[model samples]
Target: MADWNAGQYLKFEDERTRPSVDLLRRVPLSDPQSCADIGCGPGNSTELLVERFQNARVIGLDSSPAMLSKARERLPGLTFVEADIATWQPEERFDLIFANAVLQWVPDHPGLLARLVSFLKQGGCLAVQMPDNLDEPSHRLMEKVAHEGPWASRLTSASAAREKIGSFEDCYAWLQQAGCAIDLWQTTYVHPLEGAGAIIEWFKSTGLKPYLDLLAPEERVEYLRHYMEEIAKAYPAQADGKVLLRFPRRFFVAQRM
Candidate 1:
């Protein structure tokens, strides 16, 4: 996949950063000395960490140069590193390893969670929030549309870009075996938007990238038109003529002992 488009992702900055705010509110740490924001796209979530832990040394890590550049520009005082979550090796540990909307893109949740836990100091917390809306209409429609187009053959496995993250129960079991106390929950946010076009722009930054990457410019235009038509059918406009995009997310805070 091409480097993440930081500008595209930040279009819905407020909405995209809302979950990070909620997740950070539950991090049961009084004074974490060191912190790392994994997949800290454009520093929105990383800025939250700095504000909440003013005294801590906060660093943002991401694989995308565009994102890291934006993040660095957003907060030049803090450290930003280019690193892949799946293969990152740090020279030192941290009191908080925050992964907001990042882990889903990395495979092997059990192993990945354990590895994150390993990076924390004793009593340190590993806080994570991941979109759990694969079964939702928006995503289901992505798969549906992917298969119905001439680009279907090339995009056959695009849906697999985000592998099944497994159930929250499975996540609990994994953390338990990793010797951590866990707090986990699920939430569905009904985000109101102008129309299906707004909805398309939202996912175009994240979930829709894999499919769009495989198509020609004209083919992408056609694919998006079909997607928009399906989205209109799936998400009815509300009383004020706006559509509601239901986004489900899973959050967990695991404290290492």
Candidate 2:
């Protein structure tokens, strides 16, 4: 797949970063000495860390060069590393590890969560937020479109690029084994946007990337046309001509004991 498009991702920056704001609020740490923003796309969430923990040593980590470039420009004074969270072996642990809207793209939730926990010092926190919207119309439509077109053969395994986040019970047990006390919850944000096109623009930077990346340019156009048609049907326009994009996200702040 192609590298992430930071420009597209930032089009809805406020809505994209709102979960990070809420996730940061639940972190119990006070005056943490260090913080790492894992999968810190364009440094939006990392900026929040800098504002809240004024004196802490903060670093943003991401695998996408486009994202890392934008993040460095967004916060030039801070350090941002290009690294894959799946196999990152930090030289030292951190007082806080903040992962916002990134883990769902990674596989092995059990191993990933445990590895993140290992990077936290005792009493440190690991705050995470992932979109739990695989069952939603937007995503279901992606799979449906992928399978129904001539490009179906090329995208047969495309949907597997994103891992389905496990249940809360599954996460609680995993974090518990990692010796962390956990605080987990789920939130569904009904984001009001202009119209069906706005919804397409939103997912184009996210959930739709995997499928679109595999298709030819004309195929991608056709696929998106079908997707937009379904989206228009799934979400009706409100009295004000806005569509509400129902996004469900799961959040957890685990403190290593």
Candidate 3:
């Protein structure tokens, strides 16, 4: 995958950061001396960590250099490291290892999460949040469009197979096996968006990026046009001409024993 565009991702910063803020609030840690923000993109969520854990030595870790660069520029006082959360290991354990809107990109939740738990010191916690909206219309439309058109082959092979995150029950068991006391829950946020194909714009920065990136310039425009036609039917406008996007996310906090 190409490096994420920090500027593009920040366009809808408020909507994207809400889940992070909500997830951070559920963390039961009162005074974590050391914290790591795994897959921390652009540090928006990391800022929340800093506010709550003022005394903690907070470090932001991300695979994208572009994202890490923005995180560093935004908070030069804080430490930010560029590394793949999947393979990257820290020399020392952390009191809190937090990941928001990130694990969905990585495969093998069972192994990956167990590795994360190992990074936490006994009594430390691993907090994570991931979008569980793959089956939602906004995402389904993308998959449907990807498999229908002439662009199907390229797009499907390039990026259409969304990461397979295990079910809620499976996740709880995964954390349980890691020897942690876990808290797991989910929430759905209905966002009212305006303008034509506002839903497409919402995904353009994240999910749509891969498909768009894989296409030719002209193909990109065509794909969006076709996608817009399909999604508009799935998300009709309200009386006020606004579209409501229902996004569901799952959150978990595991305290290592």
Candidate 4:
């Protein structure tokens, strides 16, 4: 997969940040001494973590320097680290680890979860939220568009491969196997926004990254145009000139044993 376009993907941070915060709130972190926000794009969620745990020393980690730059700019008081979560090794255990809307992009969910669990202090909390919208129309349409359109042949390889997203049952079981007491659930948020094209704009910031990167400059426009056309038909605007986008996400909150 092509590297993420942090600038584009960061646009949806405001919309996603709330849900992520709500998920994190479920974890009973009264006063964590140390915290880490994994894949904390642009520091939006990282700032939330800082506010939630006022006394904690919070660190935000991301692979993109551009993202870290923005994060640092937004949160000068907090520290931001440029590191790939797949290989990052924390020197000491953390009282809480917050990973929101990140793990879905990593290939090995189980292994990554295991590593993050290991980084937690005994009784430390792990709160994670991932977009469970892969099977939803918004994502499915991207696959359909890429696999059947003019760019079918070249873009087929860029399509997201079918992988386990770790359902509530799977997540609970994995946490149990890792010796954690877990609380797992799912939430579908219908984010209502003005304009019929907002849905397309949302994906431009995220799901469209890899596909757009793989295409020629000219083909990119064509792909986006095609994508928008399809999205309009799939998600019709309401009478008030707004669209209701149902974004379903999954959550896993576990306390390390």
Per-residue alpha-carbon lDDT of candidate 3 for residues 91-128, written as tens digits (9 for 90 to 100)? 99999999998888887889999999999988999999
TM-score of 2: 0.99
Clashing pairs in 2: none
Candidates in order have lDDT scores of 0.94, 0.95, 0.88, 0.83
Off by over 4 Å in 3: 158-161
TM-score for each predicted model, relative to the true structure: 0.99, 0.99, 0.97, 0.94
How far does residue 130 in candidate 4 sit from its true spot (Å)?
0.1
- On lDDT, the leading prediction is 2
- Candidate 3 minimal-lDDT segment of 10 residues: 156-165
In model 4, the runs with Cα more than 4 Å from the true position are 1-7, 161-163
Local lDDT at 179 for model 1? 93
Point out where model 1 deviates above 4 Å.
none
Residue range 88-159, candidate 2, lDDT tens digits: 999999999999999998899999899999998999999999999999999999999998889888998888
lDDT tens digits, residues 1-257, model 4?
A: 55556677666667878777788779887999999999998888888888888999999999878778889999998889989888999899999999988877777877778888999999998899888887777888888889877888888756564244976777777788888999888889998876656787787757777687788999988887888888888888888878889899888899998
Which regions of candidate 2 fall more than 4 Å away from where they truly are? none
Per-residue error (Å), model 3, residue 90: 0.8
